[model samples]
Target: MAEGFLRHLAGDRFDVASAGTDPVGLNPGAVEAMKEVGVDIARQESKKVDRFLGQRFDYVITVCDRAKEACPTFPWAQSLLHWSFDDPAAAEGRAEERRAVFRRVRDEIAQRIRRFMARERKANKDPAQ
Candidate 1:
């Protein structure tokens, strides 16, 4: 999800990267959902947050509440934001039901990213206006 969003903003002034504590690899359901919206994530590999520890980030965002709770403090991070979303991979029931969950999660993440991009653009344009 984060990868798709970041790809949308790639080559811009902001630097974006995503990693998970467990790093269980990209969910197939997530890959399909993003593909529905024209974003391909099949090549992306899940990485451990530790891989980014020494780097600097203007904002470190956690897309899951549990991750936010479990993540250790990063002294170099200028800010941390928690944008919790339901874990679509955890969805159960029929196959169709599971796909629905993934679709909903994908849409939610896309909406949040769009809003964030809009605000970022506005902030860049106005600065203090």
Candidate 2:
């Protein structure tokens, strides 16, 4: 979802990537939630963090509780932010209930992206970052 937001909100500014320590494939519920918001992530595939280990990123954002810990330390990253969003895929009970959780997480992620974008814009405006 962060990738979706980054691409939609500020793709021109930063390249975005999303990965996990243990990938369980893209959740259909998450795809559905993002679809409602007009972000199509169906083509995005699940990938392990190892694929990005050697690469450098300016910022690394982890959305899950375990990922913050499982993610490797990026000495090259200027910043690392962790957000403990409940795993929508882990949501139990009915299908509607699961989708609700996904939507909640997706919305929360969108809000965070907006906040980050605002901060980045402010920093870019300043002579000193």
Candidate 3:
């Protein structure tokens, strides 16, 4: 969700990727949630962090507590950030309720990316930001 939302907003300036220490495949609810916002992540593969072990990222972010622990220090990254969010997949209830969790998490991810991009934009404008 974070990668898709960030790419949707600022792909021109950022190369975003989403991976996990132990991926469990893309959630259908997540795909639908992103689609609600016009971001198609159906083709985005669920990746393992090992695939990106040595790759350089301007910013390395972990979006959940488990991910934060599983994510290694990106020695090549300029910075790292952790954003904790509940796993919508764990939401237990009716189908619609589970999808609601997905939508909520998706919106939260988008909002966080917006703020992060805004800060980046300001920092670019005024080196001290």
Candidate 4:
């Protein structure tokens, strides 16, 4: 969801990618939640963190606590950021209940992405930042 929002909101400003320590494919609830906001993440694949090992990036961000702990060091990355969010995939209950969890997390992720984009824009405008 973060990737989708960043791509939609940031446009060509940032090259965004997301992976997890333990991927369990894309969640249907997540896809539905993104679709609700017109952000189609249906084609986004869940991938293992190993796929991006050794790659250099301006920022490497982890969106969950487990990921923050399990993520390997990306010394090549200029910055490492951790935004702890609940693992909505782990949400348990009936279909609508699970969808609700996805929606909540999706909204949270969108809000965080907006803040991140704003910070980046501000930093770009200020030389001393």
Could you give candidate 4's per-residue lDDT for residues 35-116 as a string of tens digits?
9999999998899999999999999999999999999999999999999889888899998999899999999999998888
- lDDT agreement of model 2 with the native: 0.85
Tell me how far the alpha carbon of residue 19 in candidate 2 is from the true structure, in angstroms, after superposition: 0.7
Per-model TM-score on C-alpha atoms: 0.91, 0.92, 0.93, 0.93
**Distance (Å) between predicted and true CA of 119, model 1?**
1.1
Estimate the TM-score for candidate 4: 0.93
RMSD of each: 2.6, 2.5, 2.5, 2.6
Itemize residue pairs with steric clashes in candidate 4: none
Highest lDDT scorer: 4
Tens-place lDDT per residue, model 3, 2-65, is 8788888886687778898989899888999999889998888899998888888888998899
Question: Model 4: which ten-residue window has the lowest total lDDT?
Answer: 120-129
Candidate 1 Cα errors over 4 Å, as ranges: 9-11, 126-129
Q: Judged by lDDT against the true structure, how good is candidate 1?
A: 0.83
Look at candidate 3 and tell me the lDDT of residue 88: 88
Q: Which is superior by lDDT, 1 or 2?
A: 2
Query: What ordering of candidates by lDDT runs from best to worst?
Result: 4, 3, 2, 1
Q: What is residue 71's positional error in candidate 1, in angstroms?
A: 1.1
Q: Please report, as a residue range, the 10-residue window in candidate 3 with the lowest summed lDDT.
A: 120-129
In order, the Cα lDDT scores of the candidates are 0.83, 0.85, 0.87, 0.89
